[model samples]
Target: MSDSILDRANKGILGLKPYEPGKPIEETQKELGIQNIIKLASNENPLGISPKALNVISTQKDLNRYPDGNATNFKQKVSEEEGIKTSMITVGNGSNDLIEFVSKCFLSEGDNAIYSQHGFAIYPLAIKSTGASAIKAKAKNWEHDLSLMKELIDKNTKVIFLASPNNPTGTVLESKKIEKFLEDIPSNVAVFVDQAYFEYLEEEKHKVSFNLVENYKNLIISRSFSKAHGLAALRLGYAVSSEEIAEFLNRVRQPFNTNSLALAAGIKAIEDKDHISSSIEINKSGLKKAEEAFNSLGFEYIDSYGNFISFDSQQDSDLSFDFFLKKGIILRSLKVYEMPNHLRVSIGLEEEMNAFIETLHDYKKALDAG
Candidate 1:
């Protein structure tokens, strides 16, 4: 009898807010009538696209035909690199698509999925939109509290999303800790690890061996080429999981979930080991630049293992966020993550970092005098 449009919409969606992404540089420039914008908002590679991927763009043909629905070649390439069978890989538009696929595959009305308090926003958007109950476990010091997460598990729970080198805060759950947590959780519940920033993690400490999946059938690992491979524009992501889980995920995935260019580019990007290395090197150097700048400002920051850093602005983030925008620097506000006083900045080029540092210094001086 209800005439309201929202009444027809999924009830769970009623309780959700739209996911707000970082503002694009072009949008900011057009809005402010300004130029020379440097964006540290999205965790994007400053190095841009891989040279190998760029090479394939010119070779792609057949605009008249649909892309490979199975993403056969791409899946085969991933299987080769990961040392897994193609049956175990699920291709997605982006890692976000993989997240949604898992959510839709397992969750329905009255079911619940769990994620950390400060976990990636896409987890909730993907899970809750399926009309499933989205549960949040309390985070300790802006990091996933696995014990608290375990305490929240109940019969209705279906999936648990874990993000290492987690977004916004950049906290990580070590492999040993992850294995222990997996051992404690119910075997029936799927655990989707969103590892979008997997390549950015330091090899010495990250230790995320893909062989972990061989032992845990319920485990699903989603990764994106957007961050480290500089392929954000192409919308390339995939999930590694048990064949049964991958089969179910594929059933719900769109036939052409990815485009022709994305498939070709993904293959090329994976082959360009040098490009991956160069991007990582730039990230490492940029992170150091951020540390020196933040330390000079006496800004209290979370120690991050990712390519970005989240720090306390020590004031309402709106003022600083807008201040940076006005100064042609674009980073992100953590208000959506429940840390309204924090801001996250993706590490940029050396010159861009220098500009950000100088602008920050100027802002402090102005704040003091005003």
Candidate 2:
């Protein structure tokens, strides 16, 4: 018999594992045969979609026509709000798409990309898809050790991915520390900072270095409307960089990477300050409540700047995850992040959080008794 066709696949892809997203509500219902499921797994905004965005999406009348390939108006809105030039902005189907665009534009065979341990999974996936090496630096206290990352950089390094308020851990890098690190690195290496959760941070913790894009030609900052703006379903996000790099990314991106509805909705979503504020407030309250519960239960949790919190299960997290599913709750297991004893839960409405807390206590007790 001939060798399997899989043997002819790209060498880089053959070694890669597919990303495991949080379980969907419908999938859980089917598997566990339970309804009334509340999903606190995907780190989505539980407050639901923004009314302004919905209004814009509903009024979108050109379904028969193609979307604006250039994403002009949305880019203009972002430029005006962020004080960046429109030429420096590149929109994508989602922030993940933007990540892939960067990889496609810069990474190649024998090249390498650097990211910290427990950084967003897409970083390595995107890099490896381009047949590039992904160098994971050792994390310090679940945060990016910038010095270690710098040491790992070599002539072969083409890009560096930094996730502030990193996923699964929610640890953020200090603004000045990141600036110093950037200054120390070689100018030839491109730096892509994934700030998907930037809006959830307190005002004081916000990075002034976002404006450094104007000065640093190699810097790119990716932002999303998915979290605070409640536009995840729209799949709208963008990257801000120097005009030169933006041109390269745009050249590699699909002409209609962002749809008409997403463009219209994103323009409205960014202007709805009240909705964003309310979302942040709800997250803050829910995070506080969850933290208090974890403390009383003697569970260890990372100090998170983002909307979700990862807590140690003190048992097999996969088993605990199954237990929660049986109880009509869906939380994220960190097995994919290589933290099998921890689970992450997104902030939801007060009642939803209460249910999660009560169910968690019950699960822990059952485990202890067993």
Candidate 3:
């Protein structure tokens, strides 16, 4: 028999574009012969993992034992924290996993999914993996244009993915706007609100609709421990939805998809109130620093509510990326989201942010000279 696996693979899988992650620090260091390169590309928490999660991992002793398939205890902890029933939650390898599982369970070749132009790249990837048609709605000033999305939703629409404080653009959909959109959408179409960066929102400004599980039967709220909780390495996240929807996701998800360490880390991370607060504070400080830096550089950026800001260098982003690479700094060029002139940079610690600003100044000068 021929060993050509590509030929045997499903058509949709074959057509899928592999996700391109942010470049690793080691890889950049090796390539450029630079030391201590700063990576602000992948919206990672600069404070690192919570001390509680780290302590849990330090004491974890069951590497040989299989994780709980149902994740009952962890679900219970999440239930207590969120004031929702365990049945309303489905844990994920990462929030990205839940997005993929939801797409698999609800979408098909005949169905369509709607998303904003510069939303997270994972939504389109997930929909396409299920052989579902993805409808790209135009953004209104880098934010989700719900009106355009609403108009695009037809009888065949099965899912609509909205990224609050959207990636690449860092524009959030207002609570009233989302509530209005949810009220207008058909009952059968599932609404997945990707709140991967949810914890970074200030308490007064946080407007997540997690309780919509009771009100909007078809709504799903996806969250992650990766961002504010700083558990990115553990790959722990979860979804909150109606019991029926949760059951469908559980059916499609693999048993023991979450390992024991990740579960422990997630539980501890959730309980670490101080860590969450500090992380948010640091992000707020970083945001202010970044805004001032942008103003000093005379670069225009979208006023961001998330831990990252998307700005245009008024030159090709690819050129800007290359220029920044040589300066031992990394930023995401959003050509993948079709914003070729823009770059999205994650907020970092004060020193790191200052270093990045200094690098930007040096690069700007070099550009002028060239």
Q: Provide the lDDT at 313 for model 3.
A: 74
Which of the two candidates, 1 or 3, achieves a greater TM-score against the reference? 1
**lDDT comparison, 1 vs 3, better candidate:** 1
| lDDT assessment of candidate 2 | 0.90
Cα lDDT of model 3 by residue, 150-247, tens digit: 99999999999999878978888776678788899898999999898887765544577677679899899999988998988888899999999999
Write out the backbone clash pairs for model 1: none
What root-mean-square deviation over C-alphas does model 1 reach?
1.2
Backbone atom clashes (below 3 Å) for every candidate:
0, 0, 0
**What is the TM-score of each predicted model, taking all chains together?**
0.97, 0.98, 0.96
> For model 1, how does the per-residue alpha-carbon lDDT over 1-370 read when each residue is reduced to its tens digit?
8578868888878888888888988999998898899999999989999987998998888968999999999999999998999999999898889999999999999899999998999888888899998999989988999999999999999999999989988999888888898899998999998889998877645756667888999899989989999999899999999999999999999999999999999999999999999989989988888888789888888888887999888777888899899988998999889999888999888898899889878877877777
Per-residue CA lDDT of model 2 for 95-197, tens digit only, reads 9999999999999999999998888999999999999999999888888899999999999999999998789799988777777777999989999988899
